[model samples]
Target: MNKDEQLKAAINQKLIETGERERLKELLRAKLIECGWKDQLKAHCKEDFKHKNTLYMDKIMWTIMQFK
Candidate 1:
């Protein structure tokens, strides 16, 4: 309607988006921990003599073997 009303609406929309982003960050952190992401990263790390198994990597081991 008015310039001031439009500005308020825009500010409110931005605040809602920011809140959603923060909630998403927290949810993603929880999912990463639940899925063993930290452990999976360590397992696939480029270190020697660390042949740890991971869910996705196990499926692609044939291709990985070509690199070794």
Candidate 2:
């Protein structure tokens, strides 16, 4: 892996081992909700999907996973 990728992997592993990953996720979720970004994103996504005839569940899930 490249240096940046290796550093990211190490940091992620450390976070996971220390149980900080879940805590960070919770904090991020709370911050997004507090800032109304979560609701705005949901509304924007819903609006985009409303115009589409085919909604791919996997693609939608992948997009959501990117946020997580």
Candidate 3:
């Protein structure tokens, strides 16, 4: 299998063994959102070397992640 499929299979196997598939899925979704937000922020900040804006974006992203 490909790397993505292999990772999915491994995750599924672990969930089956632990019986926490639903909870794990939720956590994964939140993590994905956080990662996406981080990527977007980095892309935006690349053109503007503004540390304050980057810090603000990080804080906002973290707050949203917490609520998720």
Please report the candidate that would top TM-score against the real structure: 2
Which has the higher lDDT value, candidate number 2 or candidate number 3? 2
Q: Candidate 2 vs candidate 3: which has greater TM-score?
A: 2
| Candidate 3: Cα lDDT at 14 | 91
TM-score pick, better of 1 and 3: 1
Sort by TM-score, best first.
2, 1, 3
Q: How does candidate 3 fare on TM-score?
A: 0.32
- Could you tell me how far off, in angstroms, the CA of residue 48 lies in candidate 2 after the best superposition? 1.7
**Per-residue alpha-carbon lDDT of candidate 2 for residues 13-57, written as tens digits (9 for 90 to 100):** 999999999999999999989999898878767866787798799
TM-score, candidate 2, is 0.69
- Arranged by lDDT, best first: 2, 3, 1
Cα lDDT over the full model 3: 0.70
Clashes of each: 0, 0, 0
Residue ranges of candidate 1 with Cα displaced over 4 Å: 1-18, 46-68
Q: For model 1, how does the per-residue alpha-carbon lDDT over 6-46 read when each residue is reduced to its tens digit? A: 99989778868779757877899899889897566555554
Q: What is the C-alpha lDDT profile of model 3 across 6-64, one tens digit per residue? A: 99999899988997998877888799777896566555555344445445666656644
TM-score of each: 0.39, 0.69, 0.32
Candidate with maximal lDDT: 2
